[model samples]
Target: MSDLKNDIPDFQTIMLPMLKLLQDGRQWTLNEVMRALTAHFNLTEEHLKIQVPSKQMGLFRNRVGWTRSYLKKAGLIQYPDRGVYQITEEGKQFLANNPPKLRMKQLEQFPKYKEWRQTFNSGNTKEKQATRTEEQTPEEVLASTVEELRNELATELLDKLKENSFQYFEKFVIQLLQRMGYGEFREDSTQHTGQAGDQGIDGIISQDRLGLENVYIQAKRFSNNSVGSPEIRNFIGSLALQGVNKGVFLTTSRFSSSAIQTALDSKQQKIVLIDGKELTELAIEFNLGVQIADTIDIKKIDLDYFEE
Candidate 1:
């Protein structure tokens, strides 16, 4: 089994076989493709159990997922329905040519895939070529992929957030702060002050159960208009009315340069400004509104282990 680990095929090596399996022209479920490929590859149970670095998924299965994605992108195979895989006529024709192996170089021959990949690189280079090049280690490729996924997720989250009501935005900020360990000691430590909110303050979180220490929040669900200096100054004034220091100003749009300057220039108060991008990122990091759909771990030979 340990020896088989070294022999396990990389995603590129798995791609051709996966496409062939799909070329039967009948829709196959993902599990069916996975099982057929497992037998085709002669992978052992231990091979199936071998984990990527994150250990959230089996290494061979992880490679297979990548293989499926690449083949689909190359116009070879597709998901006609959720979890149902089928090869396109183009894939069948390509299989008849009996390409020895499917790799990024081969996929680049398809105009759809080449054009699709350019969107990721956005003129820097192709996505696969940039990430999976000989110049990059496997870990580097994984990191680049994670970064791309994170950026896309952030954009999606922000869009969804903007679709909700202003009232929801107020409660959302409170929930996010609570998840960040801001009000861990009490069940009611966080509250959406809403109408009862002090001045323009939208909500409050008691840093302590006794409410001796508190953090204030002002949420702006602006769509097109950026939060300007007047908004920040008003939030600052609200803090003054409450006679306390710390506050967070969260917005769904962006902060104007003057708005940012106002927050920075607040001498007596501590002000933190969270714009759309950072707000979504924070929500993701704290697992406030997203789930871990999948994970892949990267690994390498450890020179230090041999030394040890």
Candidate 2:
């Protein structure tokens, strides 16, 4: 059995010790701090060798990096130059008044840390609940938080998509398909037909840049009512009139079981369905009808490049 004490300390567990290392009011390089922390922890040789799953850096070092980053974000430390940092006046004052040991809850006293925690807590309810528990690993908590944000964004996207007119929705679908590498140019290979007197087909996209093969589209802006088998049948009839073998039916609502079965049973023509949830996911995946608000880059050491 593995020794429980050998496990990598979480970032919160390192916060207090890390802060104390900088309490002497001297500037420190990251490497110097890392070395001091290794001695501070009194880690065994085996513990020092235990690396993250990626086999890049030791697990303990990663936690130290995260601890330092969080402290900086909370205004407890300052990075005067690359890889060099020093405790701030507020951080020194905090250490002077508090006990040598620090914990996550204690860090909430800082306004910056409190604001960061509040933002994190505002995630999906499930994620918020997971965050309150200590049983999960740090990686698990991060993954859950990301998934919750995605769910929230997808919901918002679907809600906005439903508010648009059917003609606009049709145009949006065509634009999305073009972004996904279908139809090289909008005017040449994609066209919106969600106008009065048109059949069930709303738009069309060419499979090839030359516009040889085409895929018909039927876009519906719905809220509560589910797309049923009869609606799918009407779409199939429209495809038949156009002598098309492939068709895509998109709705800002779910498809009923019968509608799904009907589409599967069609032997002559192929019909692809995109319900509200899937439509929004595709929109996000292809970077269509949405913009990236922020980006975070998670980096790991490249061990092989540095090997002798």
Candidate 3:
């Protein structure tokens, strides 16, 4: 058993609030819930760790899918379409009646979940059977199917790394950054000369040659905890160490009110903080050694052609 096994309750703690936000008759996208989750909980969306239970290995997609899978299995939620999730009647009823107090071991207590699992397994087999009958090229199928598998695996990776601390997580992010072409990036772990402390600057990356320019980064892996101004201030101080003026503060958790204010207040320093949410988005954007798992093509109608 690993740390995440023990941190299951923490993941549940997040999932409960997530379910509540969807209780209304509104459909929510994954990004929407992620935003609400980050703001409400003060977590970083970009982080593989705090974004969900499994993010570090870049398994963001699957972790989210797994959460929905668990919720749907427990009759706590439903997926109306790709990337869109809504609460079901049973899910609403369960919430109203039970008011989820999540426990890793207690997930099995939901009787509806067990029944749902039986039906779900049955349906999955039927779907597989139907797919087997479809006339499709093996290569074509492999291309698309491989992507889906990759996406699922990415989510799982993130979930597995969620329980690690900031120190360890920093190494992960640094590696990720280096893959994105940050060659001179190295972790800063101590104080230097006057006004040259390591504060928020956990790692430094040289952007250009001549050793004249660099980007400082601050990585934080928090456990359901919010980072405050002090951390930010220290990071700003670190920027001055090598005479670098620009910095990026990255965190797996979220920032506090003062933290955001501090960044905005100090215009001269030019500090950019990439919290968990943004970090994940960048990883996806850069394709920083991460493979794409799926691409769902949704067809929409041209109304003019169908006009009577």
Candidate 4:
């Protein structure tokens, strides 16, 4: 069943009810509150099973967690211990004045909430006002939107990389390494060793401008298969053949458990592994092959400027 099929309440929608659940001023575990919330919302068993896009956790649970986090940030609740929380005295006082239903605008009355909103919306006022809605918290909306865009970009990047040739992949890895300050100089620091009879070494880089030390590299452009222990051992052997002690194994795929263990247990050399996800993250971070499409700056009030 599609996880999105269930009508999941947004974080804002759950905030007031969640706060009310702790009105008795007694400590409550996350599990207890979640159960109470499930009953309060009248959600069925099937509804409870509705998962998030990642399929790692339930959508309703995620929303409740966010709701709790926002309340904590606003100082309306306190964490007494791991997974346990309680309503603060300020929280009870809030309930005394406000109605059962609390809206985001109403929450702005609290200093902490107001400051949080100002900080979040600072210079991006137009963007924030356009996207702000009653159903979602500003932080949740922004985070989820960024995550969606990032996931899409990652998918596109992997697809484009997979379509390229192995030789192209090797050069791409070298370019990424160079961008990350691996090679001291672009002209002579990096050398491709993936030619015929080059053993298992795909590339090498001088760690410094003087070429005092070298770092061996192995780039594997595998789309789906895992780089296992045997491949890692072969790379280490290639490093030994070159008499190098530092190496990096770059793969457009995951490394097996045994492969990771082998790299860690190696006493003769220091081996660093870059799997597909990590590689894509680095590519995005360093702008290796990607360009920034837009940028936003958030600003805040300068109280000192107006102070007497």
Error of 1 at 53 (Å): 16
State candidate 4's TM-score.
0.55
Please give the RMSD of candidate 4 to the true structure: 17.3
User: Candidate 3: where are CA atoms >4 Å away?
Assistant: 1-158, 165-167, 179-200, 295-308
**Candidate number achieving the greatest lDDT relative to the actual structure:** 1
Please give the CA lDDT of all the candidate structures: 0.81, 0.78, 0.60, 0.78
Which pairs clash in the backbone of model 1? 53-297
Tell me the tens digit of each residue's lDDT in model 2 across 1-308. 15733565666778888899999988999889988888887776777777766577878887787688668747799777668889999899888887756665566678866543443343334324446659777777778767766765665576567666777888898887788777765568887788887898888898787777998999889865889999999999999998989999998888899999999999999999998777888899998777886666778899999999
Judged by lDDT against the true structure, how good is candidate 2? 0.78
lDDT of 4 by residue, 1-308 (tens): 56544466677778889999999999999999999999888887888888876677888987787678668647699777768889998899888877767656566677765543442332222234446655678776676677645644554475467668988888888888888988744678898888778799888889887777988889999866789999999999998988889999998777899999999999999999998777877888888778886555758899999999
1-308 per-residue lDDT for model 1 (tens digits): 56878878888888888888877799999889889999998988888999886778899988887787667657788767777889998898898988887787788798657644543332222345455567888677666667766765675576567778889988998999888899883678987887753589899999987899999999999865789999999999999989999999998878889999999999989999998878988999999889998755547799988995
Per-prediction TM-score to the true structure, in the order listed: 0.57, 0.57, 0.44, 0.55
> Candidate 2: RMSD over Cα atoms?
14.8
Full-model lDDT, candidate 3: 0.60
Q: Judge candidate 4 at residue 222 and give its lDDT.
A: 87
lDDT of 1: 0.81
Report the lDDT tens digits of candidate 3 across residue range 114-217: 54333222232213433664666666555655444443444334433455555667766776777666664443322112123444456666655554566667
